[model samples]
Target: MTITIQQQFSINLNALLDEAGVPASGFGRSKHVATSMDVGVATAGKWLSGKQIPEYDRLERMKEWLGCSFDDLLGRTEARGGRIPARAENVLLNMVGTRSATRISICPDEPASIRSDGVYALPIEGDVMSPYVVDGDMVCFMPAMSAHTDGVYVIHVAERYIVRRVNLTTRGTVKLIAENARYEAEEVDLAEEVKRRNGVRIVGVVCARILVNR
Candidate 1:
């Protein structure tokens, strides 16, 4: 049977929240989301039931209260643009703006492990990292000069940037995995590809993500 946009949105929303690690009972008629977003319980319930889509302003606020992205909350598996901007330091940015790398500032509230020059802030255009990295969600990425124990990274290849999780296989090869299905995983043999011949390379490691308030 064909699904209406409302139905589809509902399905995607539930799945996305699940992926984001939201407990099913965390949001309900208890006025949790409604109170958090300053909306009515009926309005929040309607959203969960897919009876209505929250307005743009409410949607943005909901992301903050729930800690997700637009494409993520809506459950979109599309490809997002490459490269995002981050402060020169490891901190949480309250207002993340989309500007050239030269025009960003650094804050020192949230601390983490990252690099100096390796840290970059670029423009994110779409939902390639949807549910994980959404629109206006500029994140902090450190240059992945070497393999990390484990975590999502911004695989740098041919000057193009792709955000994904990477793994080092025992066969001396590296596996690249993306959060969205649109981008498939790539296995790069170190001894064969990088050592023997030049091939795709890792550019950056996504050590941190900064959620911007619209």
Candidate 2:
């Protein structure tokens, strides 16, 4: 049987949260999620029940907590000009007129800096890194650099780029952590030389994220 959007969302939401191991009774789930963004369990319960939709900001936080793609959480939506919609072009242009150049870079000027270099753009596809990085925000990447300074990065694994923080362990294992407390970090066995060989492949260091209040 075909599933309606609400049904699909409800199923996916519950499953994702469960997979993250934040069952309703545990304060760990609620505490971790609340650390990055302000949200309550009652509000989360309402969302999971499909009784209400979270505001854009909260939705972004939940996405990060679930550690999945935006499409994975929100269901698939049509792509906008090859990148998710961060802001209307008109609005960005107007903001650029007033803001400091160092603070924000207009989209039109993006290509000039990104096209030729190993750098590229990866729009954040989900909420796993919300508040700091949200769905639809553009994340810059540099494919040539494999080394990360123990922080968040855009990585291409299995042909898809995912954003997560990098943690180097004393045992020489690498852990990919989500910004949200709800999601557990994933560890991979890789030597420093192998990592430098571009086997895992670092897409780029995330400089900053651009989020619109929508």
Candidate 3:
């Protein structure tokens, strides 16, 4: 039996959600989809029910959130002989705290160490994370709702997104540390920030670094 495009999209989306460890059904599923796709819960419900598909802009957001290719999401891999097109996995590089919308393709030849589903990439643009992760390089991270002190993470604070080494202080504050010593670390009181409408959000945890060739 031939599957309709909506059916195909639903199937593909479910598969990706499964890989991400989301439940197959219920409010949890719809909520995760909504959060990941950055859409309303109703919209996510429609997509999950196969009543509608995402528009191009949302598709781009979905690609980054799910860390999959358009082919994978649109069910085009079968027509392409089961091989994902070269650099099919493209992610918009969120430079500094702004959305640049500049996409960088992940070459198929990338080492397995940095390849994984549900992983997103952010391009480093300055010396803030220097030496450990220099400018012109891209860091691959897994989308995370929370931050841990074990590693570096991309976070939203003071109305800007940045990559920093997170350290949870005993004084109920989160410290954002830059790898470059010249830059002083900043500590934020999460509760106060939220009260002031300046909230701290954990975007993702850095997993691997893709060194760009100069």
User: Which candidate number maximizes lDDT?
Assistant: 3
**Alpha carbon deviation, residue 33, candidate 2 (Å):** 23
Give the least accurate 10-residue stretch of model 1, judged by summed lDDT: 90-99
lDDT score at residue 94, model 3, on the 0-100 scale: 16
Candidate 3 segments exceeding 4 Å error: 1-117, 195-198
Judged by lDDT relative to the true structure, which candidate is superior, 1 or 3?
3
Question: Can you write out model 3's per-residue Cα lDDT over 19-99, one digit (the tens) per residue?
Answer: 454532421567778887778988897786556799999999889988988978786436646542222133222122233
Among the numbered candidates, top TM-score falls to: 1
In the range 47-134, model 1's lDDT, one tens digit per residue, is 6545677788987887786566776556433323322222223232221223234333332221223344435554444656543455
Using all chains and alpha carbons, the TM-scores for the candidates as numbered come to 0.44, 0.42, 0.43
lDDT of model 1, residue 33 = 56
TM-score, prediction 2: 0.42
Candidate 3 at 195: error in angstroms? 4.4
The deviation in Å at residue 165 for candidate 1 is 0.9
CA lDDT of each prediction against the hidden true structure = 0.51, 0.50, 0.61
What C-alpha RMSD separates each model from the true structure?
12.0, 12.0, 16.1
lDDT of 1 at 175: 82
